[model samples]
Target: MPPAYVEALGSVAAVLTTFCWIPQAVKVIRTRETRAISLTTQVALSVGVVLWLLYGILHVSWPLIGANAVTLVLLIVILAMKLRHG
Candidate 1:
């Protein structure tokens, strides 16, 4: 595969993954309640995202790093809300 194609695919994947969380974040923020959300799932996802971020950094992949970084923040916010409200 060409370098351009690889980069493009990576960008697309990153965008898709990052944007996928938008609805969840919005729902949580709007409702200001996380009672329905599972803490275990959020914790697992946060851990996974952190690992992905670390992998991206190690490989020097900007798209992965950026996307996972944003995702981690969003996840953290949701987790915090869950802990606070639940």
Candidate 2:
């Protein structure tokens, strides 16, 4: 496959994972059932997201920047919910 296709695979993966979190975030918000969610996991995810956002911005990867931004917000919401009710 061409390098372009390989790079596109990365974007596709980003989109799928980033968007997939939407449903989980929505479910968590609605049910407020976050006992199964780990505090450590959310914290680590948030940190990773922020770092990815920074890397995306520095590298001018708009797709990464946008996806990470949305993912970061979702993670923050989940983290806050977990902290509030965990």
- lDDT (CA) per prediction: 0.89, 0.92
Give a tens-digit lDDT track for model 1, residues 25-57.
888878888998999999999999999999999
Error of 1 at 2 (Å): 9.9
TM for candidate 1 is 0.80
Candidate 2: where are CA atoms >4 Å away? none
The sequence of per-residue lDDT tens digits that candidate 2 reaches over residues 1-86 is 99999989988998898988888889889999999998999999999999999999999989889999999999988898899889
lDDT of 2: 0.92
Give the Cα-based TM-score of candidate 2 against the true structure: 0.87
What's the number of clashes in each of the models? 0, 0
